[model samples]
Target: MAALGMADRPITVGAVCVYHEMVSTAVEALKGSHIPVAAVSTGFPAGLSPFHLRLAEIHESVAAGASEIDIVISRRHVLTSNWQALYEEVKAFREACGDAHLKAILATGELGSATKIAKASMVAMMAGADFIKTSTGMEKINATQPTSLIMMRAIRDYYERTGYKIGYKPAGGISTAKDAVQYLVLVKEELGRDWLEPTLFRFGASRLLTDIERQLEHFVTGRYSAAHRHPMG
Candidate 1:
């Protein structure tokens, strides 16, 4: 919190993400700040919980003061080509979120193919996802360039058709300053400058921040700081 509350220029994260158990604590700690508390709901990392329980979890998280909910989509729905099921599931999750924004985690690695990833992205957006995320950061093959390209193109297609902009979040494995910059450039090239803001794009890798801070420090002082110097919350 001290790092984010820098007196010279506060560098708040996009959001403080936590499980439902810590939503209240995150909300309290970030009180008076613009950062929203995001809770990972819907069975998280793996969306295999009972259907009703998943929806109930979303409601509970929002009631706990989470302004954003990151819900994992059922990979099985995509794997089996059950687009209707995927759409309905995400739509219900969106409705459960009420006013809170919903970020749908695709778990792309488990989906098996680039085609499935793109299809899942479209269905999630169609079902009213505020953001289509790449992964839960727990998959063995989380966040790769090819998968990101597919999802970005899906977002582009959705925008061209519906004229509604949806956000994109690439989580997992993006832990370096170079990786972060590359993703930023990719977003700019694919989605244009409009998606560059925090409202439309976000990196789910917390470790990436440390590298970014180190790079900034190096640029300013011409010296590299130890990794331990930049602590993550």
Candidate 2:
């Protein structure tokens, strides 16, 4: 994984997303590299655990030195149109995260429609999430351009209303240089130049970095490398 971080430029990933139990290991391995260990919490992928336990998980992850926490919102809240409840729920998670940045996962693929995805994104931002993510990568569907587009629009609207800048991360199914380039283009076109940076945008993908590195190597040396040569986190 550290080998993957050796790559240069826009192709180099911003953070390595991991599960809670791996947070300490990731933090130790990534030391002095400036790469953040983003751990999934709040009963991630399903988020159906007891509320207290979820909040405790967030604290444990932070205590273990996870720089960011990607928490999943209760899907029932969004499906039932309980906006205030969802806002409060996310806000509690944000508080539990303490100094660690919070990225609320909407699992857009399971939310049923673009409207729900947009609304959930807005509610997460309103609740003080530092970033809004597309999915947990465990959904039947994860991170589509259409859903991502809706989420990005919601982020834009939030920025316009509050004058606060929230980050965007499109996790799952984003592989290859073309897909990354497309996402970059979307951010550049929708949110402008500032959002192009890692502080604003990220890919919560495991294999995406290898592909991006391969493309970079091909561009520079005019040759492609084996997948094993680019060990990702």
Candidate 3:
């Protein structure tokens, strides 16, 4: 809701991700509005829950009009080298989303290795993730360039193998316009401009809108605007 009105009053937000219960309210509030509802499902930050519950959460979020579903992969399974089981879990979640876009979250901070990151990226994409995302915003280290490079390379490889162009989303701790631009540059340089649109590129930030507004204000008036609140749409 805040994201919606912010977009109206000079702040442009492509999407707002919320928990499963909040999906319906967000959809209703932002209906006919431009902001897309991206729901965080699949046991989110902890990534420790029963598989059936996670899948049900995905189903409910999609049924509630979520256009995109951000789900965390079971970090435990991935870390244990259970590649086949991990792949099938993601595939099932992808199917559960129905028409909603599926973003498989790697939670890279916990994975702890570039090799693991690369393999996880490949597994998620191959399991039908529309986008392979970085983190859940509940950790200290979320998205880093090296980690992003690994995933981007994995996506490139996947595209080469299957003719599918997967998207990338870097969530958590990306709070500055400079950082956003850097990530954008990374995407453009690594994945090409074809993936620069909101569909393929998104900054999962809680504070990004304000920074963008400040940037836009500078672009228009040559000065920073005072802090303000945008109402729910």
Candidate 4:
């Protein structure tokens, strides 16, 4: 893979978070690869399913060899200010994920406010989220600087207060090389380089790999490729 080949330099590819059904296949394919499997569970994107079904989705993903589980916290309940329900929902999903790392997707676009974003991040971390993710990559307006700042600040404060190093992941619509670099820069500036590693920081992107490859080619070669030119995965 081009990204894997680039690991000798400044950047490296992290885990590839996919859907529940794709976990087993991806895990087998990436067994000897550098990328880990991070599967989205708990009825991702919409997340309108019943609680039990969502929990089962998470459990199944972990059992299917996913090393990490990205579960969407109930935004409807969170927006309604049903703090207890939101807390319980995340707690339940954390239990279902077993030892698989849990990344709670706040889907920041739907939360609609920085204040709400901060509160939701706190709730997710307290509810046992290994990482508080920014978005689901389905919203037209996904990860923004304000929401990401709020979440990262919350993680820093929570670490000071509780000694837990909850991670931060900014997902959705983050498909450009410059955007990824800027996001990493923001994290380094705000949360420090201690949080710069893939464990504490991740950009949940679909087309990010291709974008990175283009940047690599532009650096190695003298020109950018045509839109149809794709690097081998």
Candidate 5:
């Protein structure tokens, strides 16, 4: 927080994401900074908790002041080709958000195939996910180029069919500035400039920020600093 506050130029992340228990603490720390506090709810990376418990978790997180909620979807719904069940589940999660932007984490790495990933992305948007995220950063594969491409195409197709712009987030494994730029380029080529804004696009790579700071420092000083020089906290 101090590092963010002391940056030479204006630089703020899309939001500070934390587990539900830390929502209030993040909210308190980011007070007056205009950065929304985002919480990972609905059993997070697993999403295997009881259905009612998942919905209740979302409600609790929002009530605790999380303006954004990242909820994981049940991979079983996709694996079993139960699109209706997946849609209904995401819809319930969205409703529970109560005006908080809902980011649906597909956990693409676990979905088994490109076809399933595409189908899951479409279902998530259809159910009112403000964004369709690529991974939970805990999956075995995390975010890969092919998975991201599939999700982006799904986003493009959904936008064409419904005329509603849904955001995209490629989380996990994107830790370098080069990798970050590659995703940015992919989004621009696949989704166009409109999705480039922070409101419509975000990288779930916290370590990317550190590398960015390092690059910026090198650009300004003609010397590359150690990674420890830039701390996320």
Candidate 6:
């Protein structure tokens, strides 16, 4: 993903996410590169594991040297309208995160309504989530522009009330330069340019890097190239 002059230029993705076992390797691989290794934790993509086990997984991932933790929230809590449970669970994850940034994945596609998405976003942020994410990419629907709009509005409301600028990530199904630009435009028009930076905004899909490389190649050579022309770093 960094083959596109990411080491020399400021075009790198904010972080590279991987499973817990790979955290140490990714940390060492990215040492001194200023790129954080994100570990997916809390029984990611499903989050149905025992509560203590889930928290223990977070500790393990952090112990393995993950600079950021992308955790999945218990969908049952949100589905049952249990705000207090969700808040406490997310807060526990934040505490377990230690110095690592905590991103709460709402799995918005599994969520039934936009209001639920907004509320989940607020509850996660209130519990000290460093970023509120849209999905795990395992859901049937993920990272739609409409869902992103609701999440961004929630972020705006949270910032206005609490003075904390939480980040946003729309994962899944984003694979082209045009798709990325649309998201950028959405964030700019909704949350302003401040949210455009890596600190506050990130695309969670990896295929996007390949497509972006292709677009840049076309821009430079004035012609489209085959998919194999670009190799991910």
Ranking by lDDT: 1, 6, 5, 2, 4, 3
**4 versus 5: better TM-score goes to:** 5
How would you encode candidate 6's per-residue C-alpha lDDT over 38-64 as one tens digit per residue? 999999989998999999999999999
Of candidates 6 and 3, the better by TM-score: 6
> What are the lDDT figures for the candidates, one per model?
0.93, 0.89, 0.86, 0.86, 0.92, 0.92
The TM-scores of all predictions, comma-separated, are 0.95, 0.92, 0.90, 0.92, 0.95, 0.95
Any runs in candidate 5 off by more than 4 Å, and if so which?
1-9
Please, what are the lDDT tens digits per residue for candidate 1 over residues 1-233? 24344558766789999999999999999999989999999999798899999999999999999999999998888889999999999999999999999999999999998889989999999999999999999999889888888999999999999999999999999999999889999999999999998999989999998898888777767888998877862
Residue-level error in angstroms, candidate 3, position 72: 0.6
Number of clashes in model 3?
Answer: 0
For model 2, the superposed segments whose C-alpha errors exceed 4 Å read: 1-12
- Provide the lowest-lDDT 10-residue window in model 3: 1-10
lDDT at position 194, candidate 6: 91
How much is 159 displaced in model 5, in angstroms?
1.1
lDDT of 5 by residue, 125-176 (tens): 9999999999999988898888989989988998899899999999999998
Between candidates 1 and 2, the one scoring higher on TM-score is 1
Candidate 2 Cα lDDT to native: 0.89
- CA shift at 152, candidate 5, in angstroms? 1.1
Candidate 5: deviation at residue 195, Å?
Answer: 1.0
Question: What pairs collide in candidate 6?
Answer: 1-233
